[model samples]
Each structure stands twice: as structure tokens, then as C-alpha cells.
Target: MSEAVLPMSATPVATSRAPTDWNGEAMRRRIALRYAAERRFRLLGLCAVLISAGFLAFLLISMGANGARGFMSTQIKLPVDFPRSPIMIDPAMLSTNPDQVLANANLPQVIESSAQAAFGKDGDDYISSGAVAALRKAIIADPGILTRKVTITVPASAGIDLAAKSDGSEADEAAVVKLEQARALSTGFNGGFLTSSDGTDPTVVGIWGALKGSLLTMAITLALSFPIGVFAALYLEEYAPRNRWTDIIEVSINNLAAVPSIIFGLLGLAIFLNMMHLPRSAPLVGGMTLALMTMPVIVIAGRNAIKAVPPSIRDAALGIGASPIQVVFHHVLPLALPGILTGTIIGMARALGETAPLLMIGMRAFVASPPGGITDPATVLPVQIFLWSDEVGKGFIEKTSAAIIVLLIFLLTMNSIAIYLRNKFEKKW
Candidate 1:
């Protein structure tokens, strides 16, 4: 029986020989493969970034090239006998009844007469159709100018403007050359494009009216949405019970964020316009509708930002006998402010660019004057661009591009401000 254990000795035991050969070559091969894959991934990421950047650069360059021409206009100097012009009224009448004088003064015929006397028949066509209105505006701005003989530089026709800028056909070029040789044609910066309002005449149109409306609309939107959104987020994150109703509300808010903007337009149409009887095309209505559209986005963003705060801070504040409200207001809110502002800025930018909802509420109308209050009829920059882009006139093309440039600049400014704020107060725990 003792001899049965002797069979185990026949099986030789094997131990490590140089620690299993270290497997260095296999490990090196695996490491090399991993590094190669990583390099390929990195290159792909760089290529994607470069492609996107290139597209953005192209868009900006195209806008600048086309829109730059809109900032300039062609002008021609004209010597006019103010008292002798057909549009001239008695100086006494101008002081006593300015509106009546302006209404009776046929400025178009007057400009036509001046052009004919200066350059002959059909020469008036080379002057902008808006020259009459321009002259009228000048006279209104300074009534005393009508008492003396004056030489005024007035806007040239759209055709001549194109020709002067070297963008027209050969026939147009010949006309421009003739005007230039006569010393009547000149080019100058278009100051009116920045200071005036929307008009059918492209040479006289400007974005100021739209810009002011945008400012007012955004003001209303911000005033309503910021506080509502922040508090709604606070309650949902800090105080709301985790119940079925809360869960439904949370889901509904998230879904609202993803809803198409046009749906909100319809809702606004039904509620704000059709039922509530708010003024159509007013900044008040537009802003309220946009506030509805934007509020959900802010609530979602704010909740996420609030959730990102570490629990330790809330606990620490509570341990010091701080009220729940006090903790939220003093400690948590300050820390979360940068993120909150980031969301708010993004929402405001979206509101600034929105057109569909505003259109539904009647902001698509041609608002020639800037709004004096939120309740006044108005059109925003985006709606203005939309209208201009659809015009049949060739002059409005450059104008549309210019409006787009303005909108882009505004968006850039907002995003820059957001970036500055985020970097200024961003915190880490």
C-alpha cells in the first residue's frame, strides 16, 4: 500500500524559465497597435474640425464680400435753386403749416426738373427714386436750408450704383463713365443705411428700425424668462417632491425643449393672437410667445447646471443652520450662476434669431418706423431679413446680406459675452 504513491515521481514538475520568456515581443506588438489606432482617431478628429472651420470661414467671407458693397452708395452733386424749384412753397407756409407744405410739394417732379435742367431728358432716371423723399427729409430736418441756393450730394439710381461699383454690364459701365467725366458722379459711405428705416427703395433702407425692435423684444423676453426659469429650476431640483406628477412635469419640459419652433408659433397664434387679443406684431406679443418657447430650454439647462453642484456644499450650508431657501439663494445659486447665465444667453440668442413665431404674431409686416414701446408694432432683424430676401428688386439682395451680417454680429457679441462671464466665474470643487 505504501508503494502506490511512487507513481507520482514519474511526472516531472516544470517551473519558470526566465519568467515565461517575459512575452515582451507580444506586449510590444499590442501596444504598437493601440498607439496606431489612437493616432488614426486623432487625425480623424482634426480633419473633422478643419472641415467645419473651413465651411464657417467660407460663409463669413462670402457674407463680407457681398455685404461690404452695401455699406457704400453712389452719389451725384446737384446745384438747385431752392426758391425756384417747383416743389418750393412760400417760406411763410413752411413755418406755419409744414405738413401741408410737405404734402403739396411734389418733390419727384421737382427733382425731375432739376435733373433735366442739369443733364437733359431721361437724366432723372439716373437719380434714385428715393431722392424726392431724401430731399423732403432734409428740408424737414432744417427748414432754413430751403431759403438759399445749395449744392447737395444725393443718392444715384440703383443701376448707376451698380455701374459705379463695377458690378454692372458694359452698357451700364458706359453710363457711369459719362457721369464720372461730367464730375457729377462720386462714391461715398452710406451713412443712411445705419441710421434710417426699412423702405422699398434699397438705397435708402436701413436696419435701425429692426435693430430697435429686436432690442425691445429681447428685453421683454429676458425680463420674463430669466426669473421664471431660474425659480422653476430651483423648485424642480431642490424642493419638488419626487412623485409621479413631478416626473410627468419633468418629461413634459424636456419634450417641450425638443418641439419644433413653428409649433410654438401656432400656439401663440391661438392663444396670444386669436384668444388673448394682444396687439398683433407688437413686441409685447412677440416677446411673450418667445418667452414661452425659451422658458422650457432655460428650465432644462438650469436644472442640469443645478444638479451638477456637489451635494457637499448644500449639506455644509444646512449644517450651519441655514434655511433651505437661504442655502439655495446664498450658496448654491451663486455657484451655479455662470452656468445659468450661459443657458440664458444661449436662449436669448435663439430668441433673437427666431422668425416663424414672430411671423405668426404679425411681425412680418413692413414696420417702417422704430417702436417707441413694447406695445408698438415692430419687426425684428430676422423678419426684416426674411422680407428683404424675398424682394424682386436687385438692390435688396445686398441689403439682405447686410442684414444677415448684422444679425451674425449680434449673435457673436452675445456669445462672446457669455464666454467672458463663464470664464470669469466658473468654479471647480
Candidate 2:
């Protein structure tokens, strides 16, 4: 149909709308936003790390500052007459009636006399009462110590010690200065704090008892926790079937790791104390309770470490005619040891610092003597720190800080050992 054909050039139909041009500005804006978001996230992470580090440093510094005073003791030099008639006796008499002679000996009078000669009016308040007891014990141990004209350095009272260290009140400052002018007051490293047992006197109180308890408790805890946890992990990871029960157990273990430590303490109270009738305030009970608390962490860590082992190791061992147990034990376990030990170290360190559980078991009791065995009554370092912190005396303030420092040192040592072991055992492959 020869209808009026429009000229091809004249019939200009609207072309399809042009595809949208790349919005360079929008692209730039989106990229810049992404980079900004990344930067903000990084800054937040760094700030968090820095804040944590700052708090830790502050805590350590504070503890160290106060603890330094505890390391030194104020002493007063006294010239004393050790009367040989009462104090210096035959060695045979010591073997036969030592207690009687010590009971009858006038050690207190000697100390009091010497102190009076030195401080004049304030003699009783100037020297530690515990120093008299210490002197009595020494003389009892060797009566010959009384034969000579003894010029001994005796521990000054806590107030005097504090004044000498510049932490005492204004009145104490005068006493300290007077003693200094008379050349009777001096500061020396306190060897007794490392050697002596816990005492009523802050000047004589030492962490040795608590340190021993911690060592014994950790030994028991490690003995119980490590093998049981490793075996449980081994079964769950290498042999246990994937099923509902296993899943429940896995979930329970993970949840247990997050449970409050005090709850475990209560559980220990119920089971170890109420049900079993075990001895209270013994390292045995403390260690058992801590083992319960630490096992979940070990299990979780162990499973993770075992899973990290290559499946090829298992397959290759099996292909070589090795049994499943042999494959896991020979090939997988050795590779996982480093991680397992790291987890163990972390658990032990946590156990060492735990006060609530130990307190629940009566470990907060005043243990005057170091524990000789796991079954003996004991108090750990954390408990000692807690007890000291609750004390009202100014002397205990420094003592509490000193105990905290000791705890930190032990923790650092444990972590260092963990690092060393991890590096020693870790394989490149």
C-alpha cells in the first residue's frame, strides 16, 4: 500500500531512553563511606585494647607502689643483757626440759628492759610484741645465743614501721624522726616476710603459708583436671557419635564454662561438705572444686585443638593399617599437646586466683601454719589478700597490696611457662 511513506530521515522516532550514566560522585561517596566505616571499627578496636592495657598498668603500678613498703621493715637496734643463768643452758637441758625453761625464762622482761632503755618512755609501743615471742623461740632453739652481749635488730611496731616508711600520721612522724636522731631506727629488707608464717602482727605476717597452700592446691587440681579433661575431649571429638545426647553434652560443657565461679563454690559446699563430709579448709577440697570448674574450659579448648588437626592425618593413619585409637593418640594428640597445655595453663591460673570457692570451703580461716599436705588446713594467696584487705589496720593495707603483687608474680610466672611450652611444642606445619 503506497500510503504516504514518510521520509526515512524525516520520521525521527524517540530513541530508547539512554542507560543511566555511571554516577562517579555516588561511587566515590560509597567508597569513602566504606573506608570511613572500616577506620571507625579499627579505631574502636584499638581504643578498647588501649583502655584495657591502661587499666592493667594502673592496677599493677598501684599494687607495686604500696607493696614496696611491705618489703622493707623498720628495725630498732637494742643492746641487751642475755643472762646466761636463765637463757644460756646446757644443750642436754634443751633436749630434756626445753619447754619448761622457755616457759620460765624471762625473755619478755629482757625485751621490755632493752626496749625501755632504747625508747625511754614509749618502749612498749615502740617494738613489736611479736618480736618478744620470736626472741623467746630463738632462745629456746639455742640457749647458747644468750651467752654473749647480744646487739640485736628487732622489728619495730607496725605504726613505727609505717612512720619510717612515710605513711604514718604526724604524731608517728615525730616518733620516727626522734628514733632516727638517736640512730635507733633503720630500714632493712624484710627477710621474715618470706620466711615467717601468718600472724596477728602485720610486721611479722608472711605470704609463705598462703604460697604453700596455693602450690599444693594447684598440684592437686592439675593432677585431677588434666587427664580427665583430656580423656573426655578425646572421646567426644574422636570417638563419640554425633547425636542428640552428645549435642546436649557439648552444649552443657560450653555453658558450664560461662557459669559464675561462685556457683561452683556453692556446689562444692553442698557436695564436698554436706554430702561427702570432707574436711573443711583443706587444699584437697579446694583442688577438687577448682578441678570441676577448670574441666569445662579444658574440654572446650581440647576439642578445638583436636578439630584443628587435619583430616588427612586421620585418613593417612587409617590407610596405613593403624587403628582409630592409634591414629588419634599417635598422630593427632602430639600435634594438639601445645594447645592443650595452653588451655591447662589458663585454667590453672584462674584456679590459683579464685577466692570465692576456697572461701566457701573455709579456706578463709586464719591458717597460722603452712600446709604440710593436701589434707591439711590451708589458705591460698587470694584468700590471704582478701583477709588482709578487710583488716582495719594501716599495716594490712600495704600487706594486702604486697600479697596482690605476689599473686601477680605467680600468675606471670605461670603464663610465662605456658608461653615457653607452647613455643617449644608448636609445629610449623
Among these predictions, the greatest TM-score belongs to 1
What shift in Å separates residue 187 of candidate 1 from its native position after superposition?
1.8
How many collisions between residues are there in candidate 1? 0
Off by over 4 Å in 2: 1-23, 84-100, 133-148, 427-429
TM-scores of the models, in the given order? Answer: 0.90, 0.89
Q: Taking the tens digit of each residue's C-alpha lDDT, what string does model 1 give over 1-429?
A: 564577776665455445644569987888899999999999999999999999999998989987888888999876666878886477678878877788788878878888877766757877897687678777888888777777667899888888888577676678788888889998888888887889888888999999889888988988899899999999999999999999999999999978888888889899988999988899998899899888988898899889988999999999999999999998888888888888898788899999998888899998888888999999999999999999988888888888899888888887898788777777542
Report the C-alpha displacement of residue 34, candidate 2, in angstroms.
3.9
lDDT of 2 by residue, 1-429 (tens): 343575664666568987655777877888899999999999999999999999999998888999988888899876676753234345566768877766666667778877776678777687886676667666666666676767667888999999888778877788888888989888889887877668888998999999989988988898999998999999999999999999999999999989988889999999999999999999999999999999998999999999989999899999989998899888898888888998898898899999998888899999898998989999999999999999998898998888888898888887898888788777543
Model 1 weakest 10-residue run by lDDT: 12-21
lDDT, candidate 2, at 294: 94
| Distance from true location, Cα of 172 in model 2, Å | 2.3
- Candidate 2 deviates by what RMSD? 6.1
Q: Deviation in angstroms for 229 in model 1?
A: 0.7
TM-score of 2: 0.89
